[model samples]
Target: MTATRAIVVMGVSGSGKTSVADGLAAALGTAFIEGDSLHPAGNVEKMSRGVPLTDEDRWPWLDTIGQALAGSLDAGKSVVVSCSALKKIYRDRLRQSAGGALTFVFLKGSRDLLTARMAARHGHFMPASLLDSQLATLEDPSGEAGVVTVGIDAAVETIVARALDGLKTVG
Candidate 1:
């Protein structure tokens, strides 16, 4: 039998985390969490103005996301959540919330592909201009425990299948 995963779908701003996580959640029969919703107003404001966030700006937001994940896990619910999770320290902090229960799915993609996707997106506060900042901040999670890396070039269905297969293999 396959195990249920409380996963964080992590990547740069335009790496299709939302599309992939939503598909995976449906396939896995779990809750779909939009981690951007947990971001504080100040953080959103900063991003909307094309400003990069300092670590100080993210602590409260990460804490809030961690709390939500912890709450869902403690309630025995499995969820697929979307977060940039651009740094190892950020992932480490979230690990404190649920220990080994959290798996991070890294949506790896080329900058050109991601930037085009971001440019084509509508109504998101994160502008395509900030893609560089996000890419710069991202720390590869290939060596991290409980991490599944899936390329974002494929269709959403393919990405979901690959990620689920990766989870099974890693587990």
Candidate 2:
């Protein structure tokens, strides 16, 4: 139906959001936006120091992410956002700002998988130790009306296919 105007690749830290988002963008012939780039310097430092950011620390960043989503959708271009929208309220903000032209693909996996991924990750502000906190904060978006949940262990093709299928379903 070509109804998915934008795709938000969401999950906790080290959940493969960037890789998946980039791959999805390439598949859809759309741009990929790294949500990390929108984070303020202070936020980066806080996360890098193994400090989990509170909702107050996140609102501005989330607002910027929302703006990016809105911008891409407003231009009628499919863009994939790599973001850790771990909470329902955060997702709600993005949806509100992005209006109706947005959809979310929640990349989910086990704690062990996420922890291992985080441990192996290099040059990222988020630390492996923070994985626990992130997981604890994650509210599964499974039953959300406009959300898609893809397993992390699946092959990239399978994951993409699931996301595409989710788009069709939502459409």
Candidate 3:
């Protein structure tokens, strides 16, 4: 990984993006941003109501994430962000906004595992019902440049380690 790369931990709901990204930022000695926290109120309301956000709803949120990444990079600090980033266009938008100095850690998992994980969570605005919509929106980033694809079936530590190992090859 480069000295100042902005890393995005990406996947559908319940894929452990937060746990992994937090670990990754700690391991890298950088700051971590929870992408969901940056969502506008309206977007959060929609999701909390079990409604999938439209592309119109996502652009502003994506831009906010991008700005956060860019701001951190401008301060010469490496940063890790947790985001769904479910589509290629969304990733591309982030890449552009971060001036191309971005890497993504894509958490890949089976639907059954993801559903189970979502069901076990509590107090989150996102509902397990929205998992299918997120899965449908996801465009696998496996072959994309600057992307590290890691399986999410392991313990958080193991998964973070795997992601760290994978990030080593990102340019």
Number of clashes recorded per candidate:
0, 0, 0
Q: Candidate 1: minimum summed lDDT over ten consecutive residues — where? A: 1-10
| Per-candidate TM-score against the hidden true structure | 0.96, 0.94, 0.98
Query: Model 3 — which ten-residue stretch has the worst lDDT?
Result: 1-10
RMSD of each: 1.2, 1.5, 0.9
Candidate that would win on lDDT: 3
Q: Write the per-residue lDDT of candidate 3 for residues 81-153, one digit (tens) a residue.
A: 9999999999999999999999999999999999999999999999999999999999999999999999999
lDDT of 1 by residue, 1-171 (tens): 256558999999989889999998998889998999889898999999999998999999888888888888888888888999999999999889766678999999999999899989899999988989988898999879889999999888999999989988664
Note the residue pairs that clash in candidate 2. none
Cα-based lDDT for every prediction: 0.89, 0.86, 0.95
Off by over 4 Å in 2: 1-4
- List runs of model 3 lying over 4 Å from the truth: none
TM-score of 1: 0.96
Top candidate by TM-score: 3
- Give the per-residue lDDT digits (tens) of candidate 2, residues 18-106: 88888888888888999999999999999989999999999999999888888877887778898999999999898899996678899
